[model samples]
Target: MIKSWLKEMEAEYRIEILFASETGSRAWGGATVHSDYDVRFIYKHHDVRSYLSLRKAQETMDFPAPYDAQGWDIYKAFHLLQKSNPGLCEWAFSPILYHDCQNFSSKLRRFVTESYSLISLFHHYIHLMDRNLKDIRGKAFTEKRQKQFIQAVRAFLLAKAIILEQKVPVMALYSSFSSSFPKDCTIVSFYQQLMEAKQSGELVSYADIEDAIFMMEQERPLLLELSYGLSKGKSIENELNQWIWELLHL
Candidate 1:
């Protein structure tokens, strides 16, 4: 269904789809049965003249629908890549691919993996985890709150990976990034149970998981300390330009 939709969209807009993938909870391997598909893609104009025109081309598209879909123009995607945007990095390395024309995603993933800024990704996850932590701390427990708590945990794990591993966290399973944590720790045990509960449609209150939340709070300082030792990555603009040339001609 998604592939057909992409074909239709490509034909209609006269754009070449570089790649498309599942994102959000499903891409992270943390989604429940009720989770919706979040489809994102990268594309470029089929006509090279569009790049030379005086009028600005649309850099993004958000479609309403039977399928939740969005897209970024390749130029905009490379611009964000140069800035080491964590969201773009995730899309580049997303585990589930719906479309990958001429292995475009693989090429982009290699660039992102090698050159994405450590500090950018580290702080991105840090801010994300912190915001969700606030929600978990202050909000009344409900299904929405439970989702927020899960989001916080996922962010914490990814942030922890960035600071310690010094690499893009691309694993589909967020729990798989727990190598730094102790093998039999409360965090690990709680995460496993929490995932099972979420998948089973079980309702868990804030009180039920308060200790684990505190554990995450206590570890925040250590992550910051590790982040201090990270190096900012190099520029990929020249390489991205080469990609633009090659992709345009292909």
Candidate 2:
């Protein structure tokens, strides 16, 4: 059903969907099976969509999914895909990819370094951390909500690494109490004990704030440098995108 949706979209509308995420991948790695399948894409229409404004007509298709919605606002897709957001990069690297006819996914991969902004990515992770921490702390101290805390801490830890490295860190491993980072550094080990929690669709709690705090202190300086350096003049736009257009279009 999903495969045909791609052909129909391309055949009928000339719009191309670049990527999608399968819900199952999360399940195998500890997420609930009921997680939504998130999909995203980029497309172009017969030239008009490139410049149309509020007063002008638009070409976009939005439809409901079993667990989510699907649609495309053409230009927004173009810009965001061009910039290579981390979530989008994950979409490219997604184990279960939906469509790749135009070869945009691979091309996008080569240009990702240009799209990354340490400050922007850091803020994204920090906000997630704050929310997850609050949720865990709000719950009564018990093992019931352990899974949520674990997921939160893992997210926080990855963000912490990016802050430390001043780069978009590849996602790390996770369980209820402990998590690992890119290349599998076992900074914590109790993450291995969440097998039962995993089957029950749960996460572990993180009452130990010291590890997270210490990691942050060591990482702040690098993130500060990145934040201070992201300027228009410093944008590596031409070199990065040019490399993409010339090299990876197959």
Candidate 3:
């Protein structure tokens, strides 16, 4: 179904897809049975004239329903890459690939770690955590209402890892925590239990947010402090421009 959809998109858009992958909860390995396939891709056009005008070409495309298929133009993707965009970085690291050009994805993955700013990535995750928490703030934390909490936890954990390790957090939640945090930590134990419950189709509530919130509070200041001290490295626009040209000409 996904492959057919991608073919349909290629035919409709007259662009060649260079890479495609599953993202969101599915990519992070925390999806439930009801999760939707958040399919994202990168594509390019052969027309050099389309990019030269003052009016920029559309940099994104989206398909509706059943499966959410969306894409970024290779041009826009590389532009965002220069800014250390977390979404692009996550897409590059996603474990579930529907379609990929090995050379393109592998090179992009390498570029992401080297070029991405730890401060920018940390703030991205922090923003996500803040947004998730806002969704459930001042509300009753019920079993059915645990989605926001779970998302908040994921974002907070990622933010913490990025600040402390001074690197991009792993896309997979379990792996990220295991690699950056202590094995015997309370948060890790809670996350493990939550995963078990999630897999069993059991409801997870806000009953266990004490440790999670505590950890977030503890790490918040450190993240802010590090963000101020760290320097965002050189922009990758030149390298990205070269890559985009090669793809267009290929």
Give the top-scoring candidate (lDDT): 1
Ranking by TM-score: 1, 3, 2
Model 1 TM:
0.93
Off by over 4 Å in 2: 9-14, 21-28, 46-64, 67-74, 81-84, 140-150, 171-196, 202-250
Candidates 2 and 3, the one with greater TM-score: 3
The predicted structure with the larger TM-score, 1 or 2, is 1
TM-score between model 3 and native: 0.89
Weakest 10 consecutive residues of candidate 1 by summed lDDT: 171-180
Per-residue lDDT of candidate 2, residues 1-250 (tens digit): 6667666766786554554444232523655555555554444444453344656434356555643435444344445555545555555555556666467667655555446665666666666666766775545745545655555545556665665555555434122323334435433344444444655765444444445435645654665565554422235455555643443331
| lDDT for residue 44 in candidate 1, whole number 0-100 | 94
Cα RMSD (angstroms) for every candidate in the order listed: 1.8, 5.7, 2.3
Error of 2 at 206 (Å): 7.5
Which candidate wins on TM-score?
1
Better of 1 and 3 by lDDT: 1
TM agreement with the true structure for every prediction: 0.93, 0.64, 0.89
Compute the lDDT of residue 8 as modeled in candidate 1. 95
